[model samples]
Target: MTTFDDREKAFENMFAHDQEMQFRIQARRNRLLGEWAAAKMGLTPEETDAYAKAVVQADFEEAGDEDVIRKLMGDMTQAGIDIDEAGVRAALDEQQVIARRMFIEAQ
Candidate 1:
């Protein structure tokens, strides 16, 4: 006894729930990245705060996820931080896996 309207409503509810889950997962990833970056920088408390802000700002301003990771890797290298491409790629891959999981869950 399902009508067209009922089906549409169900789809809309599912879509909204998926979107929420994706956002939550992304937020978690960002927080983790900020902590990792701060530790890598070996910053003092004050410097860590500034570094975390810069990380989040860069995340916002980057063109996309890949671009954000590339920028971070490049900056780290330029800073003489001794980070390799493999490490950067691995971090990005981990985050991508989380994102993909969220996408699948949404579906």
Candidate 2:
């Protein structure tokens, strides 16, 4: 049987691990978004790197995932890309699926 202190330590470790995993997932998503935005912008190799970093920065600085999605959708619309909310949601969901698969594979 575990003591209260032991249980508390276990919970703390679990929380830390979970937080680390979430951070890694967010970083991966940011990198992927950066790459996609760079390609869409037709940036040169050097420019692509810079553009990608900007995209990731924009994503992190947003209020939340929804805000980031809205910004992306609005930008695409302004560029005549013809995407809607449902489309953006679907894309984000698909990306999440891909990220999960990649995480599993890495393990």
- Number of the top-ranking candidate, with lDDT as the measure: 2
True lDDT of residue 17, candidate 1: 90
Q: Report the C-alpha lDDT of model 2 over 3-93, residue by residue, as the tens digit.
A: 9889999999999999888767765665666566556656688977875566567676755677567666776777667667887777666
Off by over 4 Å in 2: 37-47
Any idea how many clashes model 2 has?
0
For model 1 the local lDDT of residue 18 reads 86
Clashes of each: 0, 0
Per-residue CA lDDT of model 1 for 17-90, tens digit only, reads 98887666665565456556667767687876766566556666645566557666876777678887788767
lDDT of 2 at 47: 78
TM-score of each: 0.67, 0.74
Clashing pairs in 1: none
RMSD of 2: 2.6
TM-score of 1: 0.67
TM-score of model 2 relative to the true fold?
A: 0.74
Q: Point out the worst 10-residue segment of candidate 1 by lDDT.
A: 26-35
Candidate 2: residue 82 Cα off by (Å): 1.7
